[model samples]
Target: MDGMQGAAGTVRSGEVIKPAIAFESVHLDLGGREVLRDVSFSLPSGSFGCVIGPSGSGKTTVLRLAGGFLQAKNGSVCVGGVPRSGPSRDVAVVFQDYGRALLPWRDSYGNVSLALEAAGVPRSERKDRIERLLTTVGLGKHLHKYPSEMSGGMQQRLQIARCLAQEPRILLMDEPFGALDAMTRQTLQDELLRLVSDSGMTVLFVTHDLEEALYLGDVVVALAANPGRVDRVVTVPLPSPRSQLATREHSEFLRLRRELFGLMQDGHG
Candidate 1:
């Protein structure tokens, strides 16, 4: 495999780590129906790539493949150069349904701490990191609160906090904010942008919302439904510390969004 230079000059495995995630000639089939066909792309390390398409277009399937949840029937799915066969320990997933994902018995802090315990981080350091992660996600006050005790927004934050404990190389998010209210979803999107920037983790996000994908992804990938294949890829050119107001008003932002919307619509048709 030839290595391609990633952004920031980081060397991904196989000599190039620029694209932290890559799917080469990949295919998937379930129940005699082809889910994805010949899908391919590269997401650089420390960058964000969001998958967009119509419902049942295999957007989630791509993330699952990258996370090792679904295996590619053919081709290679690699993270940092190594081929992925099953779920890689270096990857962490945050799903849309935070309530169902988190253990009901555990409080916010406990949920995050469980991951740390598995990682063998010392108790003292684990405590410190958990606090930091929770605080970073704006959940410091809810540290002791259980899922039932917190709002939908806060519980999603807890899921993110737990994923942070492992400090995964790639963070795979599957419509994490889709179930939240509009206001809450916006707030979480802001927090997630900051989190990805600060943590320097490669992110592969799955979403059906073009606006959301535009807001979060360094590159937005649109997949066609029914065969779930890559239709187009658009790179986001917004400046850092992207504020909602400034980003929405930026010329390039609007351009990219319009372009992405067209691409998505094209895929749908």
Candidate 2:
């Protein structure tokens, strides 16, 4: 259902009129070095999109641009119909390094509650919301556990819960699950799909893992290195509620994987 249905009797709205996030002919130069070039694409509201590319391809730089950490030198980066030139509360970023994303001294709940607190959410509401989010990410039992005491996967879940606390229009993730073990990574992937679908929030994730990108993204945007630019955008044809074992065997999944691999190969040229 993607969790947007509000009414049964009334014909549901065709689609919510959510604003677009896009890069219009964007170029980025970091400290005199060209990082991204002519990058442009528009993501529909509530859609999950991914940007994949080779090492040093500026994939993370694009995420920064989207998060307003870096501004485009040649074109523009827009979020919800306004030009985003600096960090704003409307955007939330989840980085690969949980150690950096999380506060070292805070427990899981504390980390998430702080974000809600900063937003001026009532203290009572913050506690309730933090509990719900930790539970949603399967961390309910570990709410009081500090990051140093938790496993890598739990730390990552805490990071996700913190992002959810912000209630941002867009979630920007840079290789968020890349550091976890295979089994933990897959488990978190399923949880992420469930969370994003339930929340109906837009996500722009960056990863070099082709399989991870296909598994999580509604549309996968491929890029090339050495002055990165969009190479192609591929849509995942597999239906929702995708499972690790079953989805790998789906014919459409295999086909899409092959096509994306070919495109990535071409991009490396």
Instruction: Please report the candidate that would top lDDT against the real structure.
Output: 1
TM-score of 1: 0.91
lDDT of 2: 0.86
lDDT for 90 in candidate 2 is 73
Candidate 1 residue lDDT tens string, 38-110: 9999998898999999876899999988999878879999888778888855899999889899999999899
Indicate the worst ten consecutive residues by lDDT in candidate 1.
1-10
Per-residue CA lDDT of model 2 for 179-222, tens digit only, reads 99999999999989999899889999999889888888888888
lDDT of each: 0.87, 0.86
Q: Which regions of candidate 2 deviate over 4 angstroms?
A: 1-19, 263-269
Score candidate 2 by TM-score against the native. Answer: 0.90
RMSD of each: 4.2, 6.8
RMSD of 1: 4.2
In angstroms, how far off is 251's CA in candidate 2?
A: 2.0
